[model samples]
Target: MKVNPTTLSWQAPTTNVDGSLIDYELEYEVGIAGDSTEGDYAPLATIPGQLRERETYVAPIADLPLDHGEHTIALRSFDKAQPDRMSEWSEPVTFMLATVPERPLELRVT
Candidate 1:
């Protein structure tokens, strides 16, 4: 996955089964972990497309709220042909958005 100033792009995985290619159902969720299994996790977005060939997919960063501190982003991919089948979720991508701090210092010479 590639993270830019305002976007996250990555190549979708292509899985072949039988003799046909499978479509990809991309889903993402973002939230912060509170306790170990509890947090305000909400579905951020879902992008569906056909994995006909090797290509790159991008998710705009503008959609996400850029708050200070660390944030967790999760992504999942599923087969379009088999709705019930899903691939193992990719590693959760964590990003930190921090504001530049200002410093006030002065030097004195005698």
Candidate 2:
């Protein structure tokens, strides 16, 4: 069986809580929950604020510790200016993990 990787992407926030334009680089933390349980969510990765500059972020799922089943994912954004400050987690998105069988190597007629 072969499990294909999943790609997670999200739009970067452009404003602060007060509705003012943001002026600092942003960092992000990705979280995953097994079976859609809110309390089961765990941190998957933390991206440094200074390493990204685009309005969108893309994360590869090959390295994630996901099982072959249903799972929910979400992310929060923060910055260096306020390390303790973090935005609310976005709406959770659930996805299914499946595996593909390999093709036959050889066949012979008997």
Candidate 3:
């Protein structure tokens, strides 16, 4: 069985709500659902925080279940200094997976 995984990426928040630079490591919580809006989301992944010069974050959904025709993915981040506090879920990204058509059985020369 072949699978087509989706690569999701986002940049971390560089400043706090007060405009102060974020000096702590940040973790992320990812969720997935079958609707474009409104519904409970299933927990997808909890990415550990990493200190990096670039604040960009990338996550690949390799084992994403494709039972539904459409799917929505979302995620939030929190500073490791306070795990209990987390930012609201980012805007959901809706997408669908498509498979290539089967090859033709036969071909004839013109």
TM-score top scorer: 2
**Tens digits of lDDT, candidate 1, 1-110:** 33235666667655644555654554433333333553334455555553223476666676665666666666666555565665544566767666666686786788
How well does candidate 2 score on lDDT at residue 45?
77
Clashing pairs in 2: none
Colliding residue pairs in candidate 3:
none
Question: Which of the two candidates, 1 or 3, achieves a greater TM-score against the reference?
Answer: 3
TM-score of each: 0.53, 0.71, 0.67
The top-ranked prediction according to lDDT is 2
Alpha carbon deviation, residue 91, candidate 1 (Å): 1.5
Candidate 3 per-residue C-alpha lDDT over 1-110 given as tens digits, one digit per residue, 9 for 90 to 100 = 22344676788887887899988888988888744547556777787666233656666665444453556778888877798878778888877665658899878888
Q: Give me the overall lDDT of model 2.
A: 0.74
TM-score of 1: 0.53
Q: For candidate 2, write residues 76-110 as lDDT tens digits.
A: 89886776878888887777788778889878888
Q: After best superposition, candidate 3 residue 7: deviation in angstroms?
A: 0.5
**What is candidate 2's TM-score against the reference?**
0.71
Per-residue lDDT of 12 in model 2: 84
CA-only RMSD, every prediction: 6.5, 4.2, 4.9
Candidate 1 global Cα RMSD: 6.5
User: Of models 2 and 3, which has the larger lDDT?
Assistant: 2
